[model samples]
Each structure stands twice: as C-alpha cells, then as structure tokens.
Target: MTALPLTALPTARPDGCPFDPPRELAALRAGHPVSRMTYPDGHEGWLVTGYGPVRAVLADPRFSSRYELMHFPIPGGPEGTLPPAPVGDMTGIDAPEHTRYRRLLAGRFTARRMRLLTERVEEITAEHLEAMAHGGTETDLVTAFAQPVPALVICELLGVPFADRETFQRHVHTLMSLDVSPEDRVAAVTGMHRYMLDLVCTKRAAPTDDLLGDLTASDLTDEELAGLGGFLLGAGLDTTANMLAHGTFALLTHPEQLAALRADPDLAESAAEELMRYLSVAHTMVRVALEDVELDGRTIKAGETVTLSVEAANRDPERFADPDTLDIRRKATGQLGFGHGIHQCLGAQLARVEMCVALPALVRRFPALRLAVPAAEVPLRTGMNVYGVHRLPVALA
Candidate 1:
C-alpha cells in the first residue's frame, strides 16, 4: 500500500462554510482513513478521520486518555509532561479510575434522573425567552438566551446559588477561550477552583438537595469534591452554551430547514440531534496508544498519540448520506456528537433536555424570528476548544 501523507494537526475549516469540518479532513477521510500526523511539538502521531477508526480508537482500552501520557496537538498548547487529571475530571483518565467516577456520577445523570429536570429546563427556557422579549426585538442571543439557560440549569443541579452565575460564566468564558493569555487562563481556573472549594465546604456543613449536597455524603475527600464540582460546572456550562449559540446560527442560515422545524414542533428532538452531529461543538479529542495496536490497516505503536477529528468523523459520507447538508429530519442516530464508549459525555441526557426544550420554544415564541446581521458576518468561535458562535444577533418578532 502507498504511504499516506503526513498532515499537520489542527487544519482550518473552509472559509464561508462554517458548518462543515475542515475540507482537508473530509478529503483525508475519503481516501486515507488513517494517516500520519505531525504534532506541534514535532512529535509524529496518527490522525483518525473516518467514523469507524475514530470510534474504535475511542473505545479501545489500549488507547490511553491520561493527560500526562498524551502529547498536545494544537500549537502553543500545553507542552511536555502534564499532570494527572484531578478527581472527577474523568476525560483525562482511563479504566478503574474513570469507572469509579462514572459509576458515582452516572446515577445522578441517568435518563430517568435527567428527565426529571425536563420541566425545570422548560421553565428556565421560558423564563429566558420572556426576558429576551422584554429586553427588545434586537439582541445578542449568546448573552441573553444561549449562555444563561444552561448556566442556570447546571447551577440549580449543582446547588450553586443562581445569583453567582455571572461570576462563574465570566470565568468559564476565559478558561475556554483559545486566545486568552496563559496568565488569564491560569487566573480564571484558579478563581473557579477557589469558588468550588468554598462551595464544597458549604455543602459539607449544610448539605442541601442538590448534586453537590448529595455528593457530600460520599466518602470522597474535600479536595476531590471541590475538583469534581469544578469539573461538573465547567462541563455542564460551556458545552451546552456553545451548542445553543451555534445551533441557532445554523438554523437561521438554513432557512428551509429552520422553517421545517418551526412548522413541526415535534421535530425538536431530532433537530437537536442533527445540530449536534453537524456542529460538533467539541471538535477534537486525543488519545495515546498504550501498546502496538493494529487499526484500520495501520499500526499505532506504543506511546504514539492519535488525534480524533470528531468533526470529520461525524460528517463521514460512509456513515451518513449527504453528510454536508443540514437536514433536521435525517435519522442521525449513532452520530458521535457526544462521543462514544466509556468516556462519553456524562451530561448528554441533560443537554438533550435543554436543547429539546429551548430550540423549538425560541422559534415558536417568535414566529418571525430572523438573523439581525448577515450570516457570514456572525462571529464564529474558530479557535476555541468548543466550536460555536461568539454572538448570535437575532431580531425577535
């Protein structure tokens, strides 16, 4: 077999087509499913673009998710050896440790448990929509609607005071920002850490009826509880916020599809799924090979890093027909939107509940809703870890 080309990690998306993954990734997936990759640190690695290969790598135990074991792919990202993930940051660890955290948190986020939050999510969504309408016709959906709905829901779930959301939201924005100075990032993280630590202590003294309150009963140490609180807060807030913001941008740009969704409110669930598959807010993830593993006709040697192009994998033509087009009616089951396998997103169900309620509600509330600015002019979160819109300017009818 001819050797595949060695492409650099972090390819750019096509100019003007913000919904699609980097065209280079789509091209690679069409021909070479598995190809050689050169990391920013000059370390040779592997990039998996096909849906099959990407899923296999994520599910395989031989591919370690430990932060210290993997090399950072993006330029100017953390270099050299990184510390192990703290308690509750399951994404950076594997097996028994991750299993432990998953088992403990899984019960709290099950389909049934998350379903209980559906009513509350709807209430939050309605409250935000009302607030937006009261504010005016023209508004930035990111600040007014997208950001607060999830922030408030997650806050209520974790038992954090709703009054303090602004502080945490600012910190999360800074922490997730790709262009923020290292100093700013460090300060954002530290501030959040301090806040979570204090919250954990409060829960210990007066355990309420929230997630943190319930966790206080567990045998987990204070440090672990604090770390876990921060983990949940960041995970629950940033991911869904991006989804809401970016999903709205996508719908406004695709007017035909948006009209279909508006006409049939029942399409909310599938529409959310399709948006997740299309946008793929969490665009990239990495894993390090623990040993020589044969995969898709290529050998991933021990200690080698593999970058999974989630955006590419979700859009693989082999997996979905006409993968580039945004069709809300498409039965987009099995899309790796929230990922797959053991490290799949823990809050997937809750996110679905939020989107299922929010999107349809927004469109239905304002029958004449439309974009306030040119679709191309809307700012995109190009460099952030979470792919989304910086601001979704909308004209509420």
Candidate 2:
C-alpha cells in the first residue's frame, strides 16, 4: 500500500505575500484538496484545503465542533483533552445545544436589526474618523480607528462598559494569540469570565437595554450569561477590529480598490465582502469527525481532526474566479469567511454593517491616507488565530 502524503499545517504566509494564505496551502488545495496532516501533538489528521471539501466538512453533521472532541492545532499547548464547551460557548458545541443559544441571539443580529444599528455605527465611525483627522497627521490606525469603532459598537450592543474596553481587549488578544502559552490562555479566559460574571450580575440587577440585558430575561444562570457575553463580545470585537484594521491595510495596499471605494462609498458593502474573502483574517476552522467519512476522495477516520484553511478555501481558484485578486466589485456572497451551516458566525450581519459603514468612511475621510511606515514595517498578526496587521500606522491628510 502507498503511504499518504503528509504535511504540517502552515501558519505563516510567505514573505511579501501577507494578503495570501501560505503558498503551501494553496498548492495543497490545487493538488491534494484533502490530504493527511500531522497535528503538533502528533495526532495525524486530515487537512481540507479546497473550497468544495471545506464547505462539505463545515456543513456536515458528522463533523463535531465539541472542544473535547478535537486536538489543539497550535504547536504548543496543554497536553491533554479539552473540557466540554462551557455553558454558553456556542462556537465549541454542536447543535441542538448550539441551536438554542443561537436561536435566542440570531434575531438580534438579523439584517433589519443590524441595519437599525447602522445609524449608531455611522455615529461611531464618524467619531473615530473625526478623532483621527484632528488628532494628528500620523497615528497607528489600529489604536485610533480600527480597534475603537467595533469595540465601542459591540460594547454598546452588549451593555458592556466602554471604560472596560482596555481590559477585555487585552484578554481577547491573549486568547487569540497562537504563541501564548496554555497558562496564559487560561488566565486570560479566567479574567474575562470573572469580569463578565460581574457584568452579568450588574445587568441582572439593573437590566439595561442591550443584548446581555435582554438575555438576562431568560432562565440562564450567571455563569452561562457570563460565558455567553464573553463569547459574544470576543466575537463582536476582535474579528471586526482586525477586519477594519487589516481590511484598511489591504485597501491601502490595493490602490485601485481603494480608489474605487473612495469614489463610490456605496461600494463599501461589496468591498467589505470582497475584503473578507480576500484577506480571510479568521483563517482556520477546526472540526473532528464523529464517525468515518469519505470526503473529496479521501477517507477521514472517526475521531480524526480536519483542519480547514479558510484562507486557502476562499482563494480556491475553482470556487472563486481569479480568486487571488482584490476586486471590490466582485459579488463575494457565499464566501466562507464566516464559515457555513449552523456554526456560521451569528454576528455576521452586525459585522457587515460595521465594515460597510466604517471602511468607506475611513477611505473618504482621509483621501490621502497612506502607510506611515513601509509595508513590511507594519506588523502582521501572523502568529495569532486572527490573521491581520497588529499595528497599522497611517498618515491622514
């Protein structure tokens, strides 16, 4: 019998190709699509790189998102099985359990609701753009604009104190960091849980008008509420924050698309979608097979993990025509940056509204905006779960 080709997961994009997924991932997608992969912990699994296989796996009920069922993909971590998904961490648990929490929250994040939130998003965008415009000709866009807009919006939506933004954001970065140790990850999550539990208690006593407050009307316990709120805030803040920052970086680098957005702010909607497809900042999605499954000509055994390179799948030439290009006009619907099926990002519409409003506003507000540092000097979040620029310094004029 022939031995299967083996490869390790590729985390870092090649130099000078920050917008691209690791070249090896693309090669695998084109050639292997689904191939044998060795996880850092020495568990051999499957790597699904092409669009077809990735979507199939994500949409399949046989693949489980349960935290305890999977192996950590990161090179170094605690050497043991994970606990079951905490009370309300929808991302780590499969439905009908995920369905209950998702059904409760999905209505609030619907298109109509998000569209209503657009007014507030516009207000926040304007505030940050104004601050950036007046603050200085040069500043880190990440600190000044990208981070705050979504952070503030999510806080307002979730009834979190904007004053506590610094606290949670710090913890979130640690959770998302691939290089962070197991002890640090636990500590950060512990801190977030403590803060969120206190916040949930406050919301329960007073019942402010926001998602958390609304959820408080349900029968969920303080611990469940805390986990859910922390989960929601991390979902709402970190991904959108980096998308804004890194999307801005992508636009600034892709001069033509940037020009298009500045010319017609209406293009922001499509541009945001295209950017999500092109950049795919939340690049990896993990699932473990609950039973033996044949996918794309490969047999994935029961209990083996299948790591999906969303970045690679999004760029699969078969699924997306000229997939590598950053074309703001492309109809980028059905892109899997938000994943597929039940576990798809619940806050996706909210993110769309934020990105549509903020990205164009930033481009138009600073017509002469350019990187304050060289392209290479701007730091990339290469080692983090979220793929983006860590610091984006820009000159606004």
Candidate 3:
C-alpha cells in the first residue's frame, strides 16, 4: 500500500497524547471541519471535529465500529498505520451481532439497577477515607482513594473475588496506559480474558445471583460470553477509575466548585456532568464508514475511518456557549460523555451512581482536605485514553 500523503493532515503533536487532543481538535474544527489526517498509529483516516459531522457519524448505523480491530487504514503506526490487535473482540463488531451481545448484559447496567449499589459505593468511599487518615493525612489519593474506590466497586459488581483485585487492577492500569507497548497491552488483554474464562467456568459450577453468573446462564456461546464479559470488565474498570481520579482533581483544583459540592451534596450529579464535560476523558470515538455518506457537506467514502473527537465536541464553542469554563449549574443537555445512539455506554448509569455517591462522601468525610503537592506539581497522565492525575496527594482536614 502506498503511504498516504501528509499534504492535508496536520503535523503530529510531539507527545501524541490521545486524551488531550482538545487543542489540536480545536485547530481542526476551525480550519478544516472535515480534515484528512493520519492517526498516531500511522493509519490514514478522516478527522471529523465539527459538532454536526461528529454527531452524524456517531448516530448513523452506516458508520461501523468493526474496523477498529484490524490495522487502521492509516499511515505511521507500528505496522505502517495498521490498527493494533485488540485484547478483546466486542468493540469491532457490527449491528444485530453488536445489538445481541450488548443486550445480554443490558439488564445488569440499568440506572435503577445501579441505584441498588449506592450504599455500598458510599461505604467503600468512606472506608477508604478512614484508611487514608490512618495512613497519614498526606497520602496519594490515586493509590489511596481514587483507584481503590472504583476497583473495589467494579470487583464487587462483577462478583470477582476481592483477593483477585490486586492482579486485575494492575492489569487494568497497564492495559489502558498509552505509554505501554502494544504487545504488553495484548498480554494484559489475554490475562483478562483468562480471568473472565475462569470466572465464567467457576460461576457455572456454583452459580450465584451476580452479573457474571446471569451471563453464564444466558443463551450465549463461550466466545460471545467472553466478548461480553471482557467488554464489561474493561469498560467498568478503566473509565470509572479515570473519572474518580479526574473528577476529584477537577473539584479540588476548583476550590469554589469543590466548596459548592461539599456544601450541597445534591450537586454531585451536576458536578459529575460538568466534570465529565471539562475533563472529557475518553479522547475520541472511532467509526468506519459503512457506505458512502455525505456529512456536513463533506463526502465520506464507504470503508474510511471517521474519528469523532468527543472531547472536541463537548467543548465546541458553537455547541456550548463559553465552553471552556466549567460550570456545574449549567445543564448538560446533549453532552456525549456516555456517547449517543445504540452503542452508548451501558454502564453509564452505574458510573454516575458511583460518582454521585462517592463525591459527596469524600468531602463530607474529610472537610479539611487539601492537596499535599501544589496543583501544578501534580503529574497528569496526559495524552492517554483516560486523562488523570498520576497521584493526588492530599492531607485530610
């Protein structure tokens, strides 16, 4: 295959951070709404940043998510712009297949169902706070608070033995880290696959009333079950962990907002929405044009990759007035934090419930909390899948 020309694609940023593509995306939106570009992995694809185009690509079933598994059709990646092999296979399938697999687990992730886990989420958050205090007020929240909350929550939800959490959590971090090699990532994925396989078999032998057990009883093949279980484990762990860490950092840094949230616990939902908007954690949503489609006056040929900049769309000036400033009271009418259309995050309700419970509990538990390291001194995991602080060192009040 001939190398795609860089004539139209913008220059690659030095770091090539996926999480913080907001800036470069801004430039793309302003200069070329539907620009041709090469992805970090060196695959050639169309970068669609405008509000209308991004929404169109995401909502249309004509744009498939299946192409994400194979080598991306771009230039500059390890395999000359090919899509890297995925750890699991669910992310790359289409339609009724995607629909059926997603449905098998939908009942477990509903907002009402997730609500049942609130007390437990708050209990875990409080226990972590007490542990942080005993360990000394000055502690790394990422390790002490942020990471464990979601890790424990997801573990309990999946009915995975708490003893296995250390192993699973470690793999989740390595698998999601952009700095890690693709081979290491594939290893992590395989490890998780083995874990899920063992879990399913164990559940079959001694079924429990948990999500995984229910999945075992479903009319799904082992491959389908593995795809669904692997998908849930990864989806539940990485994104929520980032949210806890990033949301905490965002709140702590913005003292007024933090105070507001602390003062009124009800603000947690709105605060979470605002934080999701501001942080815009997941960098972009990948899609393949199922067929030739016209979007915002640009013709996207069938089979081309269309990368929707979710972070960019969330902050689009045309969509949100004064989008840069974070405002909790503001209504998050159409923010795609959980995405949109058929493939929107199934665990979104659970994630929000966890956040709503955890945030208020953290502040109420430690009213005098303040950062041990200065805000600027805190190292951010920049340009990655889930942007967050590496460590949130804090002294409990």
Candidate 4:
C-alpha cells in the first residue's frame, strides 16, 4: 500500500545471499507492488515483485528482451554507450530474429535429443565421483564434482576441446565470479569472445556435427555466429555448473531429501525441480519496455528497464505452498526456475535432464557422499551473478 524507493531495498548480505532473490518481491507483494530502484549500471528502473505483475511483464509484447542489442536508456548514466555486444546468439534479439535463432537451438535440446545425452551424463557423473574417491578423503565438490562434469558435457556438445576447458573455464570464472573488478569484467568478456571466435574458426575449417557446426550451417553471418557461440559458452558453462554445485550442496545438507533421492531414483526428477526452485540460479530477468505500460496501477515508461525477480516468483506463496521448504515430491509445474514466456530457457530440458541423471548417479556411486568439513566452514564465492557453492568438501564414506 505504501510506495518505497528501490534504494530503500536491502542489498548487503555479507553472510552470502542465495539466488532466491524475491525477498524484496515478497515485501512488495505484501506491501509495495511497483517499487523504484537503481540498477547495477546506475540506471533507474521499476522492480516488479509480485507474481501476476511479473508474469504480465514477461508475457507482454511491450517489454523487450533485446536491450543488450541496441542503445537503450540506462537510468542514470549519460546516454549509455552500448557496451560491446555479446559475442553470442541469445536473449539479445526480438521476436522474428530471436525466433529464427531459437529454432536452431531448439533442435539440440529437445527431449528426444536430451535422451541421447543421458548415458553420457551418467558416465561423466560416475567418472567424477570416482576421481573424487581416488583423491584423498576430502575433495572440493565444486572443483571435483560440479564444475568438471558440466564443463566436459557442454564442451562435448559444442565440440570444444577438453584441453581447452581450463582456458575457457578461467574466462568463465572471471566472468561469473563476483570477485572480478569492473575493468576485469570487460577483459573477461572480450577474452571469452576471442576464445569463442577462434573456436568458431576452427569449426569452420573442420566442421564436426556438434552444435557449433550446426550453427555455421545456418544463415547467420559471422557476427551472428560469434553471438551464437558466445551466448552458448556463457549460458551453457556457468548455469549448468551452478545448478550442479548448488543442487549438490542443497541435497547434501538436507539428509532426509538425500536419503529419499537415494532410495527412489525416480525422485531425481522431482528433486531436480526442487533444487532449481531452491537455488534459482539465473537470479533476475531484465526486460526493457517498448511502450509505456501499466502494471498493478503503476505506469512504467517506454524504454525503461523492468526486472522481474524470477527467483522470488518461483518461491511465491501464491504459487508454491510452503515455498521455502524443499519438497522432493512437490509438484513444480509452474515454477519460474527457467523463467516463463517465449524467452524461457532454451536449454531448460537439457539442464533438468542432466541434473536428474547426475545427482542420483553421484550419490548411488559413492553411497557415502557427505561433507568432509562443517557446512559453516565452507568458503562461498562472493559477488557472483550466478549463485553456486565454491567449494563443497565431501568424503566418500
């Protein structure tokens, strides 16, 4: 009922904030629906915190996801210098263009296509758990389990060389880690673009039947190719890695959930959903308004940024009863973990399938997977856009 400045919203969480972001949204739904706030880039935008309002913002045609593609208004800065465009094909395009490229991406991530990758995912999970087993008792699960498996799987899918994983992973670490400085962010983005461009050239020369090669066959120009490859690298590498790491951490800490998942492998499917809801890794969804829009009686101006707290939406009390409690058997049909609308995650199916396969396999293979150190003592990576456990020290009992 009362209007609040977005600056009045809480930002500092030294103990580490999970990606479950809608704390402000919950406050908004309870009190303030449309709140004004400054974005990380210092631009003023409206933060939509309620479920209906957020969903309307996502589905409405007046909102544009292509703010990254064009010189759009930033709230505070002098006409924002369009940061160098993302060197990959993804959320930066509008309907016809986005739809065109999405068709190409849809082919590789279909349920049928994902089924083919299942065995490989299981093998990779088993291999990582085995390697962790061989290493002396305590191993950082982020390094030992979470990071490598998805990196290997995604690399295999895109035909990126395994030897190049460390190289690309460094660029990825710099890009996703909260620790990187502003200057370092640009450098990492540029470096990642360069890595992807070189990989594209190699794929051009000796075409393999991987996702990269498939994209080259499309009508995309060289610039678009870079965008496509860069998008995949950024989206594929970190998101899956976060899911794997954070999901594992969530399960390992919840003994009853872990035991239930171990007892019935079918629980893996539901567990994956619960974990995605629990972690809500992608954090927030940013959209620019193409026209002035009225949301919950508050008008958002054209060309202004509107961020939907997908993390909060997923945990909305209206949507999920007892939203904070992780329930493996919980029906998770409408959760916004991968978002909703036409721009929903293209790789959601693959990511979910990977989790269903990877999580159960890791626990079944090790049977005694428990944290090697106290949960409180574990070091979490700070300042990251993508939330994940940095180090999950676990022992094979």
Q: Which 10 residues in a row give candidate 4 its minimum summed lDDT?
A: 69-78
Per-residue C-alpha lDDT of model 1 across residues 116-171, encoded as one tens digit per residue: 99999999999999998899989999999998999999999999987998888888
| Regions more than 4 Å wrong, model 2 | 1-4
Per-candidate Cα lDDT values, in order, are: 0.88, 0.89, 0.72, 0.74
Q: What's each prediction's TM-score?
A: 0.97, 0.97, 0.90, 0.90
TM-score of candidate 1 relative to the true fold: 0.97
* Clashes, model 4: 10
Q: Cα deviation in Å at residue 258, candidate 2?
A: 0.6
Q: How does residue 103 of candidate 1 score in lDDT?
A: 84
Q: What ranges in model 1 sit over 4 Å off?
A: none
TM-score of 2: 0.97
lDDT of 4 by residue, 1-397 (tens): 5557665234343443443453555777557656776654556777766767778877787888784523322232224524544645467667887888878788788989988998998888888877877887777778887878888888888887878878778887886765556688678777877777788787788788888887788777766786677677667778888788778777788889889999999998888888888677776667888888888888888877876766677777877888878888998877777877888888888888788988888888778888887777766554566777677788877
lDDT of 4 at 308: 71
Q: What is the lDDT of residue 223 in candidate 2?
A: 95
Give the per-residue lDDT digits (tens) of candidate 2, residues 184-262.
Answer: 9889989999999999999889998899999999978899899999999988889998999999999899999899999
C-alpha RMSD of each candidate structure in angstroms? 1.3, 1.4, 3.8, 2.9
Distance from true position, residue 316, model 3, in Å? 0.7
Candidate 4 Cα outliers beyond 4 Å, as residue runs: 13-25, 39-43, 68-84
Instruction: Please say which candidate is ahead in TM-score: 2 or 4.
Output: 2
Which residue pairs collide, candidate 4?
43-75, 44-75, 87-226, 87-227, 88-227, 88-228, 88-231, 89-227, 89-228, 178-383
